[model samples]
Target: MIKTSLVLFFALLGLNLFAQERPTEDPAITYANTITVEDLTRHLTVLADDEMEGRETGQPGQYKAARYLEEIIKGYGLPGVGPEQTYSQPISFISERWQEIDFVINGSSKRHLWDYYAYPSKNADRAKVMTDEVVFLGYGIESEEYDDYGNQKLEGKTILIMDGEPKDRDGVSYVSGTEEASVWSEDISLKLKAARRHGVETVLILDPNFQRNLSSARKISLDSRMHMGFSEKPADNYSNSIYISSETAKTILGSSYGKVVKARKRIEKKGKPKSVSISVDLALTQQKKVKELLGENMLAYVEGSDPVLKDELLIVTAHYDHIGRRGNSIFNGADDNGSGTSTVLEIAQAFTLAKEAGVGPRRSVLFMLVSGEEKGLLGSEFYVNHPLFPLESTIANINVDMVGRVDEKHAADPNYIYVIGSDRLSTSLHEINEAANEKYTQLALDYTYNAEDDPNRYYYRSDHYNFAERGIPAVFYFNGTHADYHQDTDTVDKINFEKMARIGKLVFYTAWELANRDERIKVDVGVKP
Candidate 1:
């Protein structure tokens, strides 16, 4: 009897160990796999179709696209935000373009691109500004070590300042007392803030390399820009500034030009501040043509299963608007953003499925498809400023823009995606994404564009930036740019649906881990807006 009992007990123990070691499939992977190429292709076909008219913001096509997204999220049974629980968030913007600008110095009109360039100032009291006797503040450096204003009353006066700070012979900076330039030299805003502090009406920045930079500046100045119509002007706003070449500076300074140059040299050598007064009659005239338009951002919320954690939110965003058509040619931005929109839609569906299956996330997931990204990330900006949920409770944002076609850099191996702004705010967020990719997708996560000094500046170019600016951790997924970028040829046929599906699944998996985790990821690093 004892031997028989021992045999049964051993067998039972073996059975229990086997059961404990058994590997059950994760529900996240099961749902993530549902994001297939067929679904992505189906959504992309409708989004990138020629009938959409390129889906420009504030246009008919864009409105149609917003409705389509709204219908999809509503069909998935995700709850909407705002009064009446509607999916649409209306945003108004003003489109302004410079109609004409005339800068006359000493009764001689200067050419716009060749001699001078000025941006439209929305806060200007009038279209015309005339001043006599300009003040030349050397280097515009205002600090305990050096003060250029020096008790002078510069209120309502125009000031001229050089572009860069004074540097010593050994390449050391006089302001910082080191090789690295100070904020006064690196950021132009500090100088503008100083000017605004003293109630200076106008500022003229003297750029010795103005001609070399003219081409790029001219292109940006000529393009019409958009601004929020509902928001108040920023406190640091100082837009009445003109970038002038040395020739124009000479014209304004007259005989004082040589003395100004000598003063700059003396400051660089002896670390002394100099303020010079130059008498000149300057008259500036600017006219802008303004138009008002409205756009929509679609939001669908999936409430979490956990009562407490449901309050914390995870946001997934994509821009639905593309550049409008030119004449008869349609800029069907398939790879530009249709892929991203489709991905967000599919991810939303997957989460909805999870909710239906009683395995939904612990924290709420807000799926947002925004417009005006092509214009200037205006939709995200509006949402951040006017949030339905408190910004403090918002944990993170995952933004997808252009993840369809592969770029030239990844031609040899097209199975790669650029991951930008991942580690900028939260190291834990970066690790979560990396672990997700390694465990599931196995795609090459490229951080080339995440470099602080990257020339492309991809981190700041997308909607993710608006969240990152407000100290929220954000990550941007992209497939880089291809030949058909912004071209009419960026059609559905060029998109790799299989690759896009993989990327979508990656986003889904990462979001799943983020939402269901026991604790919210810490913001180890913070940024200022």
Candidate 2:
């Protein structure tokens, strides 16, 4: 009996020592592991399915997707942060489409898409303007270096101007004094501002690349566009402007067309302003249809355990919208954002599970699955403009977009993600992400798209940009674009589930550190809006 008792005691002692030596598993890692490939695949399969109708904002498929997400988050026991404690924040906007536009010069009607192109103006549903004489403003540029308006009385006058600024012999712009185009050339709105300043009622812009511009503009003009319904009407905004081809300008300018071209050349050489008056009979008419539409941004939150820190929020975002159906074909958008939405769902579940188990983060975390991302980041834009929580209290945003498939750059090595705008706002946030990836995911944190000069301009392309613009630190995780991006071919079967789960784990681990940390991540950098 003594021998048996001694043996049992020694064996128990060995087990206790082994337990002491082995470090306790971190609850963060424990919960992060729950974001498995199976869960990601399962969530993505439903979101990217054809029945969801591509999840276009304000459409039936989008509502279905929103309901599915609401159900999932509600099932996880997370509270809704939206109005009336509902999972949805209702967003109302105006959808406008141009129906018919007529331009007549000297009683001869011009073609709409061939001779000119114009977008629906918020000013009026229908407009008619008649002018017997049109002012010719060379380049329509107003600046200290060169002024096109030069003491001209343009009040209620119709003006015709050429597109782009004058470039010198060495191909340097006279306005910017560089090879790069200035705001006058880059943003047509600036030129319109110049026209509006002069009290011009109608502005005709002559495009050198009219055919190419019209072709591209035609694609978008065929589709209806949405804007905030409460915003200013078109009449309250800038003057009515129309883009016209050289042929249209020739009809309007008559003999003055050659004189206007010579004026542009003279200005390019002498760096001076030239203005002329052209006598032409013109009448313009535009008709548009505006419809009010409603969309939703699905929001749910896990309140922090600590009282003081719970007030400060961390946001995790993903856009659940895609380009809707085209005829019978559907743009499933599995990799474009279905992957991102699923990752967010899984992350939300993991956080909820952690909270239920009494290991929640110290800072509140809000999970936002937004719509209209494919529509122009409208959902996120609306959220930042009309936030449920104080924008000042929001600490950081972590956005996941397009994290499913391998791009051509990573075909040989698929274990990588593009991290954008992390170091843009906070060095601390960027370091935290790097540390999380190093310790847990170990996936290649590629910053290929993070460069300020990156031609892709991806930093400003996604939903995270809305938060970043509001001085909030943000990080965007992406798997990069594939051949199937934004196409109907972006189906669920092409997703790299293992890679997606790893990215989700990395996001969770990063969020874990950010939320539980004693101090909020400092914004050491300035935001350029």
Candidate 3:
């Protein structure tokens, strides 16, 4: 009787649906089609396995993670978007490390050498400066409205200055009437670039943080890698970069007297050049030769259905590389981004399932697992600069980084996932996300990282910033930081698979809405700092 009732209920319901002639727009169907926790868990189990050796970037573990992602993408019956049968991108960077750096001031000509301490330049070649006079460039910034150059030009000169952008007259980061987030348009790097435009040889930052981290800077340089291209030639060169203590700097500038100090003070005061009173020679000692290593950024695209809108795409990105190995233990990164990478794989699967169910999206999707994110957003930086697809035609990007752990601040409720950059560049993208959540999983969506001073630097830390830099609407999902954030203990067992699945589902729903929407989100809302 139970079997008969079940069959009869289904038959009657089918007849009623046929009578209603209901379209396929039913919410019930979409919800039923979503992937389950078990499905997502199996994938995570394999990717986050202990044998993978923590999946460090540039290591065998990172290669293992890459192969796993490729195999899964292929198993889903989707064609490859990369060249021929490969999904890997090779990338490298020219890195440097300093050792035994010392200098003296007060014209005593005394030199001091410290262990792996000095300023390291990102220049492609080695430079040496033995006793070059350091010019105080103030903020080293230049703009049309207010030039920080102090009406002076910088060419073939090494500069010294403060770390960040200059504040307004009120000592705040922004102008009083310019809005709270106006600082984005005022990047100090832009000022440095201006100096670079005048052929500046090297940049020497003298911020307190740089002063304290001289040893790390040298170590990072010594332990650096060349991102792309190779060179067999030695790195010996004519110019070199180094740092002097504030006391030494004062003495050295005392030769120029009032000019250098006055310029630095003015640069700090209003971020404008007050003018230079003297010139100092830059002497560099060629240190070492630079070699090239290889690495790459990965990109793939899912062709869209609609002819008119196929050119417009939605981007889904995450970084696959971690800090590589540290001593004996591997940084498995099960959470830092192993979590985000796993979620991307699952999302690709979910979308494939949707396609099989004839619910494929109207617009195209590009699923990218970038490299070198932990290395100062290098991979995404390259992609944005040399995209596989046109940037302007790309509508938006949704980035996933470190989504495995429930933030300790919000550990009491494990269902939360941090969302950042939702409304910064595009209000419509933000709206689509909000509406989709209300209609889908209904999990608690958190945006604690959205605050300007939240300090985690989530906005500027990940691949999404690359897209945001080009004025593309972007959203980055994070699960906050933990005790093991950059440590080797961010292992697989710590992952909350169930919560991870829910977060993936949320991302899926949001992407689905964006993919099928008739119009792409607009970026007229503008970005904040």
Total backbone clashes of candidate 3, pairs 3 or more residues apart or in separate chains: 37
* Candidate 1 lDDT over residue span 1-529, tens digit each: 9999999999999998985455235889878978999989989999999888999998889988888888888899877787779998898786555687889998999998889886554334347889988988888778887778778899889999988887779998877878987888777777877888888888899988897889887775676756676422323566467899988999999988888888877887888888788989999877766666679899988999999999999999999999979999999899889999999999999999888888888999999999989988989999999888888999999999999998999889878999999999999999999999999999999999999999999999999999999889999999988789999999999998889999999999999999999999989986732
> Largest TM-score belongs to which candidate?
2
Q: Assess each prediction's global lDDT (C-alpha) against the native.
A: 0.87, 0.87, 0.68
- Looking at model 1, the pairs that clash are none
TM-score of 1: 0.62
Clashes per prediction? 0, 3, 37
Taking all chains together, each candidate's TM-score versus the true structure is 0.62, 0.63, 0.61
For candidate 3, lDDT tens digit of each residue in 66-117? 7777777778777666556456556665644444333433224434333213
Off by over 4 Å in 3: 1-33, 82-85, 95-288, 291-293
| lDDT of each residue in 1-529, candidate 2, tens digit only | 9999999999999999986555247888888988999889889999999999998888999999999998888888777675578888877677666777789999999988889988664335557889999988889999998888888899989988888898889999889989998989888877877788889988898888999889877765676756675533656566778899887888888988788788877888988888778999999987777776668889879999999999999999999999889999999999989999999999988888888877888899999999888878888999998898899999999999999999999899888999999999999999999999998889998999999999999999999999999899999998888788878999999999999998999999999999999988889998764
Give the C-alpha lDDT of model 2: 0.87
